[model samples]
Target: MRTYRYKVQTSSYGLFLGITAEAIQLNAPPTSRNQVSDRVWLDTGRVHHAYSGRKLALNGQEVTWLHLGLREYTESIELGAPGSYVLIIIHALEVVDADYAEAALAPALAKWTEAEFGLAPRSGRINRDSTTGELTFSWDERPQ
Candidate 1:
């Protein structure tokens, strides 16, 4: 269970997440359409400003892989019986209460239990650990 922490700040319109080359796995299965972005879900809040959201593709960013938006996020993934792979954890934004930092969308997360490069959202909220930051959606590996 790896944890990728993303920081969200309020933009002039809505909110934006800063993604870098290290934010996602650079080396994953190649796609015919590398430009296509895969979707991941944000359980904390609903997003009201997707139109303003664009890939903040920064210069000199090591984007060997890019993630497109999907309808959701997944919990576990089966990358070919434990073949070496990186889970492309993307940091995107959706609309939610500003006070809460985490939402456990376990149902959505479970979709990836054995998926090969699948995108799904956490189905529900599991825990809210605000020890570090108070405005973040995060997850760890499923307990053994």
Candidate 2:
């Protein structure tokens, strides 16, 4: 299984959701349009503040894929700055076979969103060691 990761700050909450939805659309499995739902489940906890309750799941593929398919996790890091400015790492994982999965959503999201710390939101593709399952990530230099 491959993991797609993005880095963002508290201020980019809306940007995060936008890019995520766009990424899912970019990588949606091939199927009749009517089979997929347009609705995304978001909770109030992740909507305004606290960062503890915020989670977004795009289970729109249940009809087509027969499963939730895509799952996301957001890690919040407090910087102790005024206004509680914090960094967030968002990760998306596809549970289905790659052939019918939205594996490209992260990369597409990275392309559509702004960069941070001079690095794309999707800093790199995460590789899991087949034996140990240890993950590794790296970002390639693209022409600016």
Candidate 3:
């Protein structure tokens, strides 16, 4: 297996972290006034699973968030404004094999990562594994 890493710097103080699946699902439904959004019914069990049964921390500190769950088939995270750097980790297994895994998903993930953290694409670092099928991306403050 291979591993890939990317670094990003966000202007926003807080970071939004979730699986690509959740991001896609969250944006899949059409916007309408009369209908309840699909995001309201999204299942976020995976997000809980990722954080549970392990000591998960960002920048050497435990991650604190206000909300974590699926609403309308989308997993969401709401951490108060705190940090600027965020690391994005993506595994090949997380996506379907037929989808070409990281190769196909990296671009979208990068775009979402930038938007979620309020960072420009040029401000982030992206790394991908050729053989192991792993992708790592991170965002941090840029030098002036």
Tens digits of lDDT, candidate 2, 1-144: 122333333331211222222212222323323221232222111211113334445444322221112111111111112223222223333232322223234443343333321232434453445677343333555436
RMSD of each: 11.8, 16.7, 15.1
Better of 1 and 2 by TM-score: 1
Q: Which ranges in model 2 have alpha carbons more than 4 Å from their true place?
A: 1-108, 114-123
Candidate with more favorable, higher TM-score: 1 or 3: 1
TM-score-better candidate, 2 vs 3: 3
Worst 10 residues of 3 by lDDT: 60-69
**Which runs in model 1 stand beyond 4 Å of their true positions?**
1-51, 54-82, 98-100, 103-144
Question: What are the Cα lDDT values of the candidates?
Answer: 0.28, 0.29, 0.30
**TM-scores for every predicted model:** 0.26, 0.23, 0.24
Evaluate residue 61 in candidate 2 and report its C-alpha lDDT on the 0 to 100 scale: 36
lDDT of 1 by residue, 73-132 (tens): 222333222443333433342323342222222222233322334333333223333465
What C-alpha root-mean-square deviation, in Å, does candidate 2 show against the real structure?
16.7
lDDT score, residue 75, model 1?
21
Clashes of 2: 1
lDDT of 3 by residue, 54-143 (tens): 322222111111111111112122232222111222221232223322222333444544455454344434445556645454445645
